[model samples]
Target: MSIVFEPVRGRPNSGGRLTVGTLYYGDARYPIRIEDRALAHLKIVILTKLRRNESFALSWEKKPADGSGRGTVWIHPALSFHFEFSGSKEPEINMAWLEKMSESANRTLGLRIDDEPREGEADPAAARAGV
Candidate 1:
């Protein structure tokens, strides 16, 4: 499946709906409009953390555009289980593409993909087996 990237900005009027700009991927540069409420799963993840009163980091690397540095973002979307980025140090992941990748990862792996690992945890399977 094709991925999409969009620039996100915080809006004052809306409570948590971030504005997006310039969706790019696979010959498509259309506009993207996503509200915080629309990404329900992400919201669930974020709220869970917020309820626990924890802080974390989120990151993604985007494919290079215009031959410059790639897309990436490291932010704390405290209200959701995932995050979005528009810039990256690694060219393979993009902020705009993070949601979809997380969705797919969650679907295939049957687990949550957050920005950081739990304390003392290095692998997903390790937690599953109670290691």
Candidate 2:
């Protein structure tokens, strides 16, 4: 007989807690660590535009470890997307921040990830988009 064991997962961090989540891009296996709150906002903006057949660029500043430059991608409706969240509870969506992002998505530069705006309330777009 042989005995095997798997490593434990979902261990909490030391000291200060993290509101962090990882976003894995495609089957290529790129992992992007993002704050849970911001990812929640981004999920809305990214999918909403795709639903309307609007294509745009999505950019995020790479961390120092990732070479400290900005990375971007052309986001089109044809591309496949799946958002996986770690927490069982969904992070609250901030409307003001979403509006800021949506407006930027409509611009020529596409959707550049910016620092979050002041937190606010509900998304009127969700109702209109029939989600």
- TM-score per candidate, in order? 0.28, 0.70
Clash tally, candidates in order = 14, 0
TM value for model 1: 0.28
- Badly placed stretches (over 4 Å) of model 2 are 1-16, 24-29, 119-131
Question: How much lDDT does candidate 1 score?
Answer: 0.33
Model 1: how far residue 131 lies from native, Å: 16
TM-score between candidate 2 and the true structure: 0.70
Error of 1 at 13 (Å): 28
Q: Give lDDT tens digits, candidate 1, residues 21-83.
A: 222222323222223222333434444545666444323333255233423222233322224
* Cα lDDT, model 1, residue 7: 33
- Extract clashing residue pairs from model 2: none
State which candidate has the highest TM-score. Answer: 2
